[model samples]
Target: MLRLHDSAQGRVVDVVPRVEGRFSMYVCGPTVDNVPHIGHGRFTLAWDVLRRWLTFGGLDVTYVSNVTDIDDKIIAAAARAGRPEVEVAAEYEAMWWEAMAGLGVLRPDHAPHATAYIGQMVAMIEVLLAAGHAYRIDDGVYFDTSSVPDYGLLAGQPLDSLRAGTRVEPNDQKRSPLDFALWKAAKPDEPRWDAPFGAGRPGWHTECVAMSLELLGENFDLHSGGQDLKFPHHENERAQAVALGKGFSRYWVHNGWVEVEGVKMSSSLNNFTSLTDLLARADQRAYRLLLLRAHYRAPIEVTPETVADAERALERLDAVARRFRLEPLDESIPVRRSDHPEIEAAGDDVRAFVAAVDDDLDTPRAVALLYDLATKANALADGGDTEAGHAAAHLLAVLAGSLGLFLRGTDATLDAASSALASARDEARRRGDFAEADRLRDELVTLGFVVEDTAAGTRIRRA
Candidate 1:
């Protein structure tokens, strides 16, 4: 069994699946109003690591992350650009997926879009209204937060305390400041959907409730997102389910924020870093390694220095791969350690890695364990323990692959020009031509390869 920090409970708890041998999870996805930033990348990677680890442990997992195609941000962006909201949403949504692909995030099994599920959201609002848990005002229908007894469960604050702390909105029609809009009345020149209550759009909080219930059903295994959503967004989602007397997510998980200079990265703050720009400058795999080095529930700083450090660490893993002539692990296929002879031989280290991950997805510790194993494998090979070294390298590859960080061995597909340089370099070394070997090494480096001297002669990989 795995454990995770459930935000609602305000502590780490066991993540017992609602069904045996399977898991169902929902994560709030991008609003698609603009390009994704480092914060978005961190949350997606955090959840992707969890999903991959569960699959590696032989559990069938269904992951649903919804896109908020219709939102205040999308509407504003469309109005400013003088385009249809749909067009604006579509453009940004494409960019969102492209960024995810660059970071190697697995696509959600069911990516429910807000526009496609408007009918369901309207239906849910109607039920809430009929049950006296919602009321229509001039602006739109509002969910009466007072109706839900434990409304602040996810926020971990009492209803009275939340009301006292919440800033009063100018909309005096609302019964309380805590009451959020369930549906927003359409304004002039804005997209509208005909509803019995009025012509309007669904509130941002309503979409996830409707889609998660429709797709994952009641009491799904987990509902996760960035820590920022734990407030009114996720709390409101839970409140609606409570009002309807439906079992919502069994566990609420939230990852920590991506920060810069100790401030949370956000577009509003204007301190955000573009995910696209980061990928362009560094190895894409370095971001995944960087996230893994920090606990999911801890803030991570994304500076040029940190990213470069991760890239250097990856070279260490690749160096071990080259030393043992290891092949890259294919992640499309599921690998079980019990089925692999090499992994079975290194049982202690494998068990340690699994134990670290199972305990609240302790990826930082798990990452350290892998680095230690990489060092051990290199040392063993240097000591002429060839068989021991191979087994250790195999273990490192499999463990890292399970976390979606695939290691590269030798570059067999180097272009002819690069291959010729490598061959020449090896020849120069064999003839005791130190100056010639040095010249050849510098030439390969200039050609964008990290050249290394190995027992099997010179090995080179892309920089």
Candidate 2:
């Protein structure tokens, strides 16, 4: 059983899906008006890890992450670039996916874009208008916050309390200061869609309300996003769904922040570091490992010292793989963490690793458990406890794979000649021709490859 920190409950609770064995999850994807930043990377990796683990735990999962391809930001960027809004959206969206691929994020089961769902957005807004949950203004249609009594649920504040600090003043058309736009009427040179209310676009908040329900259905098992979205964005999205007399999400999960020099990295703050720049210079796996080495809910600081440390940790994982000639965990097939026969044979470590991650994704401890397993495997194999060492290595791989860390022996693949030489050396060792095996090993070492023999077989890695 996985216990996640449900933002709605403000406590850790077990995720019991309405339909047994199948989990429906919706994560708010990027509004790609610019290059991806470190914060974007963290949010994606956090939910990605959660999604991967759910499948790893043998649960059927339908994960839906959307793209806000048409937004105020995207429109603005397009205007600045002297291009069509769709072109700007498409360009950045491409960059977004390219960056996500570099970070090893799995593609969503369905990626519904806002532009494609304009019809659905209009229909949902009509339902709200008919239900008297929304009203139209000179600028556009606005959701009547007063209609939904419990509107600020995800924001963790009461409507009255939140409205007290509301900024929507001097707007006489709106009934209350807390009222938000459900649709924005077109301005000069901006995109527009026909709606009964007017020819305009859907507000940012309205986009997810329609997309999530239309794709995943009413009352999906989980709706997740970063902590920054818990406020007005998520709260407003929840309100629209509730106003239409539909259940939106059973659980709301929010991941923590990423910090730099002790301040939150955010575009609004103008302090975000680009994800592309970081990935270009640092090991992508190291960044993933760095995220995993911290409690998923804790703020992670990406300094040279931390990233260099994560790289060293990744080396240990690669060492185990090389020592055992371990086949890499394929990202395509996510199975139960202990499916490996060797891992199942190792008592308790698998269970302990699963427990740590299952407890609200306590990845810091989960990573520490992996290090412990790696240490045990290395020491046992060195001390001639081959069987136990194999089990520990398998356990480590299982845990790492659950978190999407596929450990490869090396990035360097051997050429045909080197492969043949390695095979000949294996044959020589089997024939008790130790002298010949040593000669081949030296040849490989001279070619910048590290070679080792285990009880299972000989392993090779690039030096």
Q: Tens-digit lDDT track for model 1 on 250-345? A: 999999988999988898898998999999999899999999999999999999999999999998998788788887777555455445666766
TM-score of each prediction: 0.97, 0.90
lDDT of 2 by residue, 231-307 (tens): 98899999898888898899999888999899888898888888898888777888899999887778889877787
Worst 10 residues of 2 by lDDT: 333-342
Q: What lDDT does candidate 1 reach at residue 407?
A: 87
Q: For candidate 1, what is the TM-score? A: 0.97
lDDT of each: 0.91, 0.87
lDDT: worst 10-residue window of model 1: 331-340
lDDT of 2 at 315: 88
Q: For model 2, which pairs clash? A: none
lDDT of 1: 0.91
Top TM-score hit: 1
lDDT agreement of model 2 with the native: 0.87
| Model 1 pairs in collision | none
Residue 77 in candidate 1, Cα distance off native in Å = 0.7
